[model samples]
Target chain A: MPDFDFAQPTSLNEALELFAADGEVRALVGGTDIVDQLKTGRRNADMVVDLKRIPELQRLEIEADGLHIGAARSLTDIAEFPVVLSDYKGLADSSVLVGSWQIQNRAGIGGNVCNAAPSGDTIPALLSHETSAIVASSSGRREIALSDFFAGPGQTVLQKDEILVELVLPPIPDDSASSYLRFIPRNEMDIAVVGAGSFLHLGSDGAVQKARIALASVAPTPVRARAAEGVLEGNVLSDELIETAAVAAVEAATPISDVRGSAEYRRELVKVLTRRTLGISRDRIVG
Target chain B: MKHISITVNGDQHELLVEANWTLLETLRDHLRLTGTKEGCSNGNCGACTVMVNGRTANSCLVLAAEMDGNEITTIEGIASQGKLNPVQEAFIKDGALQCGFCTPGFIISATALLQRNPDPSEEEIRTRLAGNLCRCTGYDKIVMAVEDAAAMLRT
Candidate 1:
């Protein structure tokens, strides 16, 4: 790793100013992925603006709107937060599943989304909740839906001078629940071969009022299974309907053959995990 | 170069370090604390595990500059007044280590686990120590050692 200047900015404005002054700069939070990237020469920067010191980026608040998760909050903190665990179980599940316990103690949702890996665990879960990313730059702040934030693998719509500030999730409706599941070769400390996250709101009539499905490790970015979700909307969840939605999820995936799994295998896992996650989400609503 | 203050093993040190130097490098090269072994250095193996502010973390993944104003505990800090910590004693008594290369990291991780959860079930112990990899002893003795350590601490 090459030597670079390091700045710990206490405020978002100061961080933005530092970022604007430096042409080649990277924001360091947990440094779990980026440090490794730097060691491997995969990423290079002249300065690293540490955002962990920024108070606003480390706060976690639950408001009337929903939960406001500070971008720099550790995964462990988010996973164990009472509000998150009770109201956003899928996010909590994905938070704890990001890495090992030690990694979770440092890694946060911000770096996870910013790194923008196709197999990132938190992404599909965030997308399932319809979360929005609050990004800040010298120009000002803007909110981008989590689904629209990712441009590609290892890329996002965030400008070089911009930093992700927080993730805002809308108020979870009554009788609504979500689940995130992934097929990993190992139980822990391994990336997902295929991941699925499902969020569903069941109406009093026992039909699906709303449904959101997101799949990971199946495309260049975490993708929404819109067609699969379309199958669930306004319909009672039956095994046959779930099978159809699962098939649609398979069709939605555009996985490539990698060492972890073949494209076909990933597509198959997508169907299986999609079915399983939807089943879990439905059970949460009914049970 | 970056000047950072860190409390390691209860001793405070102010040092000038290169920005790219990891906490592992700072400990081994600068502070001369070679007990924290570097196995994978990519966060895959927890050979460089240390307690940063009472929580175990992979020091290899943390930049030295980030250690500023942080309290760190390494394997060297586990002993007290020339006495081996209970976890270390249990490891020795249970024959948990063979090569001893991964011993320090496992000790640090086990100490951390016991600190947080005094009475950890076998499965809980396994889950907590999942990050640390030991090539020798096949982990059975290591698990027994942590269990024994928990019991010993309770008594």
Candidate 2:
């Protein structure tokens, strides 16, 4: 790794000012992604800013409106957080599934979203919960829907002078439950071949009033399965409807063949994962 | 280079380190704590596992500059005053190690787990140590050693 200047600012304003510099500035929470990227020459930085010291960016709390996840909070903190486990199981589930315990102790969800890998495990879960990104700069702060945050693989809409402060997820309504499932060749320590998350809100008449389905590892970006979501929006849970929705979910993907799996295999995984995640969500709601 | 203060294995040192040097390099080169081995410089392998601020972290992934004001516990810190830690003792008794390159990392990770949960189930032990890969020995004896260490700690 090449030598670079380092900054550990204690305040968000101070950190943003560092980002407001002339040369390339990299903000790292865990160093799980960026450190390797730098060592391999995949990413270059004139100045590396460590964001863990910033107070506001490390905040994790539940407000009246929703959950505010500070960018630097470790995956361990988020996975075991009580509100997350009870109300947002998909977020908790995906958080623990990230890396081994050692990696989870350092990596944070904010970094995962910002890194913007097409196979990022947490994005589909965040989308199911309708999360938003709050970006800050020396100028001011602005919030973008998580669905709209990515530009492409390893790219984000964030400006060179701006840093992501946190992610805010809307409160999960009553009669609702969410769960995430991914297909990995091994039981752990592997990237997702296809990941799926399902959020369902059941109506009084036993029909689905609201639904969200998101998939990963099947496109340039983690994508929402809108057609599958449409299939579930007004229907009750049945083996037949779930089968249809599972097949419909594959329509959102434009997967390419990769070493982990082939394009056709990923498409099949998308359907299987979508069905399983929906089943898990349904089980969580009534059981 | 940047000046930083870090507490390693109950000793404090203020030193200058290149911003690019990883904590693994700092521990092995400057501090002469070579017990922590660097396997994959990337975060994939946990061979360089160490305790940073009481949590297990891959030293190869952390910058030495970031260790400022951080408390570190490397494998050299595990045994105390010529007495082997319970995990280390159990590894010896159960023959859990082979070539032993990965032994230090496995011990550090196991010690951290026992500190948190003194009575972790076998499944819990396997899951917690998933980051540290030991290729020479099948995981059966390693798992047994952790269980033995838990019993040793309880009594």
Candidate 3:
């Protein structure tokens, strides 16, 4: 790794100013991925603008509309946060599935999205919740829907000058519950082979009012199975509907054979995972 | 290059390093704290584990500049006047180490975990030590060593 400069800004404005000053500067948070990339020569940046001291990006606030999770907030913080666990159990559970306890203590959600891995565990969970990213730049600020955030594998729509400040999770609709399930080879500290998140809303008649099914590690990016979602819409969750939805999920996937698993295995796992997650979401209707 | 000051093992030293220089490199190369081994510079092997402000972290994942003014405790800091820390003593008593290349990191990570959660379950120890890999000893004696050290601390 070449010798470079480091700047730690104490305020968001200062961090933004430092970023705006250098076109080659990269924002550093958590450093879980970037530091390793730098050492291994996978990434090269002339300057690193450290954002750890910026207080605003570390806040987790719950508002009337939804939950606002700071981009710099660590995975352990998300996993253990009471509000997160109570209001967004799927997201909390997904947070704990990342890396290990040590990595979870330091891996930031913002860094996860910014790093933009196809198999990022939180992507499916965030997609199920209808989350949006709050991106800030010196020029202004804007919100980008999480669904539209990722451009491709290991890429996002974030401009080099803009910084992701927070993730705004929309309120789950009434009578709706969500669950995230991922299949991995090992129990701890392994990446997901196939991940699925199911969010289902049941009406008074026990028919599905709204539904969302998102999957990771099955496509170029985290993808919503709209065809599968349509199968559950306005229909009571039955074994038949679940089977159709699960098949549709397989049809929606574009997984490739990798070191983790074969494309055929992932397609089959997609069907199984979709059924399991939908069942979990449907069973939550009892209470 | 970045110039930063860090307090390690109760002593403060200022040094200049690259933005990419990890705390592991800063400790082993710059500060000459050779006790902190560099088995895998990546975070996986965790041979460079250290306590940053009382929290255990992969020193290789942390940039030296990010640790400015932070308190870091390495394997060199765990003892006083050449006496072994209780965890180190337990490691010897339990024959927890064979190659000994990973002992400093294991001891540091285990000590940090036990300090925070003194009465950890066997599963808890396994979970916390997941990042720290031990190729030798098969980890049975290491687990027993941590339990023994916990009991020693309790008494």
lDDT of 2 by residue, A178-247 (tens): 9998999887888999999989889877799888999988988999999999999998878788899999
Considering only N, C-alpha and C atoms within 3 Å, which residue pairs clash in candidate 2? none
Model 3: clashing residue pairs? none
Off by over 4 Å in 1: none
Candidate 3 on B34-114: residue-level lDDT in tens? 998888776788788888888777888888889888899999999878999889999999999999999999999899888
Candidate ranking under DockQ, highest first, comes to 2, 1, 3
Q: Over the stretch A47-156, how does candidate 1's per-residue lDDT look in tens digits? A: 98789989999989998888998888999899899988877889987987877788988897799999999999999999999999999999999999999999999999
Model 2 CA deviation exceeding 4 Å by range: none
TM-scores for every predicted model: 0.98, 0.98, 0.92
- What value does the lDDT take at residue B38 in candidate 2? 90
Interface C-alpha RMSD per candidate, 1 decimal: 0.9, 0.8, 1.4
Between candidates 1 and 3, which one is better according to TM-score?
A: 1
Every model's DockQ, to 2 decimals? 0.79, 0.86, 0.61
| Cα-based lDDT at residue A59, candidate 1 | 85
lDDT, candidate 3, A143-252, per-residue tens? 99999999998889998888999999888766778889899997677888999998888898989889888999999998999999998999877899999999999877
Q: What lDDT tens digits, residue by residue, belong to model 1 across residues B24-88?
A: 99999989999999999899889999999998889999999888999999999999999999999
- Index of the highest-lDDT prediction: 2
Tens digit per residue, CA lDDT, model 2, B1-100: 7999999999999999998999999999999999999998887779999999889999998999888999999998999998999999999999999999
